[model samples]
Target: MEHEKRDHALLSASGANRWLACPPSAKLEEQFPDTTSDAAREGTLAHELAELKVRNYFYTTDFGKRKLNAAVKKLQKEDLWQDEMMGYTDQYLDYIRVVAMADRIQGTAEIEKRVDFGRWAPGGFGTADCLLLKGNQLHVIDFKYGKGVPVSAEENPQMMLYALGARDMYGILYHFDEFHLHIIQPRIDNVSEWTCTEEELLEFGSYVKERSALAIDGAGEFCPGESQCRFCRAKAVCRARAEENVRLAFSQDKGKLPPLISSEDAGRYLSLGEDVKKWLEDLKEWALGECLAGRPVLGWKAVEGRGSRDWIDMDAAFGKLAKSGLAEEAVLWEKKPLTLAQVEKLLGKKDFQDAVGEFVVKNPGKPALVKESDKSEAITNKVTAAEAFAEGGES
Candidate 1:
């Protein structure tokens, strides 16, 4: 079973999750094993509960406290109700209550379709959370319960993918004019709507077919951006993460801890290392210029001298007060001392010791990267900002 499972090309949005962060995320495939954290499990549980609530609303003839109780029971049967189950029960009840209330007026309870996406991947597969069938139209809804950034359903790639799947599955069953993508987040007071057009769906379907092929060929490593990296599974092993760290180190001017390359970066670096190294040098040069001028780039700081404090010579200042019978502690005042490199070194325990044992601290460049404003005569041929920016374009 394990062998068969391994042989099957089961594509997941997980790799896409990483690729969205950095193109070279695939390099970490072997190095970084996937693990499900609490947040992921919670999301899964919440989604299951939401699905149950929707299912009960659509299928059940009864719509009252009895239905709410039934929904709660259904969630428990699915093993989704655990620790803080009442909160989810309340949530399910509230949603049903809202739908019930809406039904009295216009735009009430409607179940368009459930689990209705047609063909998704290499295999004919798609997901349908719940669809609302209401007055001459269909409304598609997907539940998002994670702490991740809210995705707008209109231009959202995931929703479009789902929509494409829906078009393949449900268009024939029900002739629809307008499509609505409703994103519901119970944890957050989020109820977002996105209207999609037929033309848009067609275009998105074509995109999915084209992109799906890349996944089939195992080429899902195209990097997206920094914000996306926070949720990536391959963050530790992603070459983009390494490159980002390198870029950040150079950009900040404080030297970063030695180059920590992930396995993915190491693989790609075997061929493209030289080019990346040159880019790093150029980036560092540019960073140095900016740092010297005290410009903030990347999340790094300029080497502040050291933090220190000074105590006033109380006897001198408090002589009159002491003679009049005031205590020394009463007149003693502490003052902040000026920061300097020497005091900074003294701040650390090992740094405070003379050359001896493990306690001895060596001059390890800088804790972070440092950009010197003024260069010594020995430091010649520094790459300037204009040179660094123009180097690639000139070619």
Candidate 2:
């Protein structure tokens, strides 16, 4: 999959979720440069690792074996390896196997399978994380490494695109009548699934094909919304989005009656709290960018925040301090690495943790509500069986 050049498609299935909503997004995005992030690299590595595992165990194919091995070696050398990532991949493999067994199929798994939707989507093609066929049912599984937001499959265009593409690629031979789409987002503990018949699938395709064609020609309509704009590259300078957000502020600022806000007004403002916060953050980023380039922003100045002191040459400074008849301990705070409780009055947080970080004590976090599916093992745990049994017996 890495061998394929990402030809900056006018429409791609991965961005289908965004382009379908804001049809002009793909066209506008072409104006900005595509930058890779650490998060994206980690996601790619995770996908590679998961694919390697699945193919090694289930299907025995040497497709991209040499390239895959090299990529796997490169990823294994990275510091991004985490237990949960491996666990998530395992869960994905397990789910596929379970489904395959249930449907009386074996060795139907296809890893990193590229599918082309042909005329159903213009210049549309994407690699499904995993694709398999079981009788008349066609199951498409996608793995998402993001923990930010849970992606749903209800009317999901990306999954729909993959389904259509897979249909185009393998439909001739298998003649799939049923479709089951699944999204496994392990980082957020979100496992979402949706099923649709072949008839309903084609009905949704008509809308995608038209939208995709318009998007490819840069003739798509500009529709702005929170979901559509979240991952958009042009969002920072998009006039439509700026205007939409400005309307909200305009609605809030008109005709102020009293010093104290009414309950209704307060509730409305509270409802828009997230939007306001994001706007402020974007404003700060813009102001900083302008300030750094020596273009001063009105009513805002750039100033350095509080900074810690550091010696120009720590070893030389220590030697110089000792030569000046001052003890080394006086100039530099030196102590054996140990906990405060274990060795009290040793050093301050600035002195010790700054120098010997291993001795530092990490703070325990506050309690917060979290989903049962949360794998953090944080917040709090429910009552254990033993505790429940003891309480029940006591009562």
Candidate 3:
């Protein structure tokens, strides 16, 4: 399948949450050149493969099958292609099939359908990965190929915008009453769905319109929260973000520092430390980039920091080592069993579970501090009497 170039709008649905919060960030991001990473390219291939599979499955023709086969062959030749991508894309297809079956009414699906929501967001348009229309219900399914973060459908601005765009394009023809938004992230095994009434969607549209107007003109205050700033191009040098972090660090009254931080204030600072740490890392990365580009960063200069040596031919090096008195098994190559995940992937999920599911045991994850909104259930920390006494030291 040939991939078509997509034109991004000023207020793109993918960056809706960012611009909706900090309307000025939309225009600010334009100053930086758009860059694509290897991971992003890999994701594009995954989506293309997924679309081809869906096309062949839904609209089966000899020509379509041939095209899909050709595309798959081409995809395999790509540098970023991985065997796991096939499994992940197949997982996505399975879920899509399940969704199609859930609705008793016969449905029609559109793959990579361009949707325009200009009614709410001015000139706002985006492509919905899959749009399944079943009588009065419309399903907007988005396939996320990245496994870095597990995205949720509930209150997601991107999915909401996609839903709005689908509604705008198909409302008259389908008479849709409810919109079901789905996020399928197969790599992380995250499948989430959120349902909302037409009225609710329209209400959110109104809010998007207000923000869109501001974003187009770059006319709002820069709100620098973690979610909005995470992907912002100008985040590295954004003054607002720096100011926010600075303010969080120092809570002084009238430019005078407090003698000591209270326990309550310490907890608050700890919560905000992650944001501060991220800002500092971004600042360092930006400074390094500037120095590397032959631009002086005041006190910073680009220099080789550290270096390491590696054998160019590992097998030859091992062969040379084996010629010596050292045993190959003991010094050259020590065999180790494959990881559980690797074994499962090799054997296939069902087959692996059937073979050793009873023997497999999953340990509880270590406790970690996270935001209140985290979906994971909280664990209580139990302090034993011995531990309390040890801390007190013979109290």
Q: Who wins the lDDT comparison?
A: 3
lDDT of 2 by residue, 157-229 (tens): 8888889988887767788888999988876678888999999999989988888777877776788766777
Global lDDT of model 3: 0.87
The ten-residue window of minimal lDDT in model 3 covers: 1-10
State, as a TM-score between 0 and 1, how close model 1 is to the true structure: 0.49
Q: Give lDDT: candidate 2, residue 185.
A: 87
- Model 2 TM-score, 2 decimals: 0.74
Task: State the weakest 10-residue window (summed lDDT) of model 1.
Answer: 1-10
Write one digit per residue (lDDT tens) for candidate 3, span 1-395.
Answer: 34446888888888898999999999999999777889889999999989988877778874387788898998899998887788888988998899999957799999988888888888888888899999999999999999887899998998889888887777778788988999999988889999999899889998998999999898999999988998888999999999999888775557766789897777777888778899999999999999988889997788998999998998888888889876888877878999999999888777899999999999998889777776779888888889889899963
Arrange candidates by TM-score, descending.
3, 2, 1
Q: Which candidate, 1 or 2, would have the higher TM-score against the true structure?
A: 2
lDDT value for candidate 1? 0.52
- TM-score per candidate, chains pooled: 0.49, 0.74, 0.87
Q: Tell me the tens digit of each residue's lDDT in model 1 across 203-229.
A: 666665565666555566655344455
RMSD to the hidden true structure, all candidates: 20.2, 8.1, 4.3
Which should have the higher TM-score, number 2 or number 3? 3
